[model samples]
Target: MKLLFSLTSLFLLICSTALAYDNEPNGFKGLKWGTSIEEFKNVYPNATLQKQQPGEYNPANIITYIVPINESKLSGITITSPFRYSFYNNKLESVLVTFTGKDNYETLNKQKILLNRMSMIYGEINESSGNNIDEFIPGLSTSYYNFNYCWKGTTTTINLNGSYKEPNLSSYLSISISSVEIRKQWLSKVKPIDKTEWSKIRKNIISEYRSDW
Candidate 1:
């Protein structure tokens, strides 16, 4: 009985430690994608963001933020944009940025400003739901764009696309930025779910929303 009790206690301790590390801020807890507007707000309270109403070109909500993590130590940042309708179909767009050494902030800031500008470009269209925005701006393609970010040996690329739409013409954007080194170190120390697991979590959230609608 004594040996069994000791083993049970040890197991509980390990479980508790794992849960603590998993829920830590700036950890993987913050790197989720495809989450709803409400869920995103819960995680990023400091983002001070806003959502636009549906219109001719505008989808639904526009979420923008300057990541709260220490940019200097980050390995990369990824932004995932997913659009779902009252129907069951799901559309996803992703972008990545990798940065290292000096000028990291410059590159990161540039990306940030670009996102903000993009938001403004579509701001009116987003407000009107694509009605007011001109269909042909010379080389312009679509109105919606998705992207991601990461850090490599001082070089980074912000991938983007203008394809995605919501049922009510309302769309969703989820951004996640992290340092590769920090993520690996923390994950190595804790027993959190891997990327596959995290992806499931995101999918489940989307599924739940779909079911509710």
Candidate 2:
């Protein structure tokens, strides 16, 4: 299940599509895609550098910064999550906002709330869903499930993704926003990735759970 989930996420990272939707989100906060990292720091002085790590699909390392503004309203629902901005080649390439709850039910409920809001705003441009159930032991079962809704604009793509695992009852929910157009530009200028960098640049999604949990 872990291997399958990772592969699917990797494919989606490379296959981000542009759409004609006018209401889709194209940037993070008020910053536009491809904004310089220095300028980003100027606009967000309180943002702290998380790491300068290899991006999932880029040859060089990408820098990540985390800000304090964590609560956001999805239409009427209030969601609290850690938000990170990532830059590749000194330009903003992606933003990730994630929320994970202690238990499955609470996380799933929040996922539904956010999904409803996304549907209202983005109109559900795409859907990706799959699951695997395994009877690991006698009278015991293990399962992994994934469901994601996507929307795209002229330059960006957004995905509201949810994943649940049985036995552990752990859940992960995220709002992943990427500059699909800028990513393409970056891809054009970078060197071809070798085996070592390819392994180093594996997708590193940092998911933060609720503190109250």
- Candidate achieving the largest lDDT: 2
Name the 10 consecutive residues with the lowest summed lDDT in model 2: 132-141
Q: Give the worst 10-residue stretch by lDDT in candidate 1.
A: 84-93
Per residue, candidate 1 scores C-alpha lDDT tens digits across 142-183 of: 343222321121111122212122121222222222233322
lDDT of 1: 0.28
Off by over 4 Å in 1: 1-163, 166-168, 189-203, 211-213
TM-score of 2: 0.72
Error of 2 at 22 (Å): 4.2
lDDT, candidate 2, at 43: 91
How much is 137 displaced in model 2, in angstroms? 20
TM-scores of all candidate predictions against the true structure = 0.25, 0.72
| Model 2 spans > 4 angstroms off | 1-12, 52-60, 76-78, 131-141, 188-213
* C-alpha RMSD (angstroms) for model 1: 19.8
